[model samples]
Target: MPTEISSPIQGSLVAIVTPMHADGALDLEALKKLIDWHVVSGTAAIVIVGTTGESPTVDVDEHALLIKTTVEHAAGRIKVIAGTGANSTKEAISLAAYAKSVGADASLSVVPYYNKPTQEGLYQHFRAIAEAVDLPVILYNVPGRTVADMATATTLRLAEVPGIVGIKDATGDVARGSDLIRRLRLLEKGSGKRFGIYSGNDDSALALMAMGSDGVISVTANVAPKLMADMCRLALAGDFAGARAVNDTLMPLHFDLFVEANPIPAKWVLARMGRCNAKTRLPMTPLSARFEPVLEAAMRHAALL
Candidate 1:
């Protein structure tokens, strides 16, 4: 009989931004600084080169360099979940292999985007990566960006795949998230193979964790790592009231970070804190002037400023 595989991560995981210079070049120094900050801030892990990190713009070589640098700098202080997802299954496998070789603790592989593969294809795609790489794989489902949602059934099916440890549920559909948890419990009992779900959305993370989610893979954590870490810790510890209290302070950031497409407003706040230069790629424009006050107000509310 196969023993149960408990989740290795559970807490505030920052879907961190890639700090770039004003000229739009990668700032490895700033990246190291952020890693140190997360280690001190009690962040459980970091998902580097994810959506907020502008993975689309970074070429494959840059992707590997970013992951390798993060793993080296992190140096066991915090878990590094490298964003190794790609629309090409072959590319995804290669990236995951590179992550494992570089000592990354895990890989966050988003559902293949634009291709819009079927549910079965999704299973095969993720299962292939799990089989190909020895590193832990966390399935990322954000249909808002991917255009292909991984249904609960597909996730339930993928649960049986070895090396596939957990998922990041960004769908923000609480009812379905609850349903997946309920079903997973039954499945785990039958197979003795366990998996977990982490909320990919910060605003509804409390509600999801209240039901059964392990924690959050958060964009809000980019600026307010301490508060996000505290909230996840409280929620996971069954201190809903305390978590709620902390969340009341962060509620504005949860909504405001997305006010100008993630990492834009998030970078603005980080820059205000003098953490980074707040530069983004070409297609992803700078944070518009009109929304600055809204984000500023959020930063003040969260005490990030």
Candidate 2:
């Protein structure tokens, strides 16, 4: 059995946004402040360079620098999970190694994207990464963009690998997520060690936590860290009512934040909050005016202004 972390990463683990200057460069000063804010606000963990960080746009050097800077800025105040996944297996290995070198607590590796690899391919791709690096690996199965979803069986298989820890199940399919939890628990029954399961979808996190998920790799937490952290804490403590109360307050913002592609609305909200400037790479753009009223109303409802 693979040795598990001493405790589950319960509560909000923010898939934090990368702070960018108006010139399209990473704002190290702003990034440090965001980390300090999350730590002070009771965020359980800090996830840097994930989808919300615009990983697709960040070059390898910048990506490594982001992870290193975040880890340094966090200063052991919270866990730092580096987003090191890439469509190319070799690239993933390279990134994972760098994350480990920089003292990342774990590596959140997404399922291979674009190429649409088969299940065997997914297992091999992740297996290669785990084998190549000693860092604890959390599989990221975000099929909405990745196209290829890592199935429960494959995730379980990878969990058997020495350094592969668990997954961020983002299929938005509750049944599949429940089944994966059952399977991992069953593995623990015989092996005496359990793996962690975190939800990738913000909306489904409450439900998944009700079913025993450890926490969520949340994009929503970037702007509303305290509420999201409180929600996850309540859920992990089996206080579903409390979790729901926070979720209900956050529901509108959550829905509106993703009215467009992730990081787009997320960036806009951060800018509006004065946390960071709103800028994105060529492929993604600012939130359209059509969605402005919806987001504004939600923000007002949340009293974020």
Clash counts per candidate, in order, are 0, 0
lDDT of 2 by residue, 1-305 (tens): 32346555677899999888877888989889889989988899998899989999999889999999999988899999999999899999999899888899999999989999999999999889888888888899989989988877888788787778878988989888888888898997886656889988888899988988898989888889988988998898899998999999888887888999888898888888899888877688778989988888888877787
Q: Which pairs clash in model 1?
A: none
| RMSD in Å for all candidates | 1.7, 1.5
**Candidate 1 C-alpha RMSD relative to the actual structure:** 1.7
Write model 1 residue lDDT over 1-305, tens digit each, in one string. Answer: 21224655889999999999999889999999998999999999989999999999988888999999999999898999999999999999999999989998889999999999999999999989998888889899999999999999999999888888889999988888888878887898998866878998999899999997789999999999999999999999999999999999999999999987777888888998999988999888999999989988998998877
Q: Which ten-residue region of model 2 has the weakest summed lDDT?
A: 1-10
Cα-based TM-score, every candidate: 0.97, 0.96
RMSD of 2: 1.5
Where does model 2 exceed 4 Å of error? 1-4
Cα lDDT listed for each candidate = 0.90, 0.87
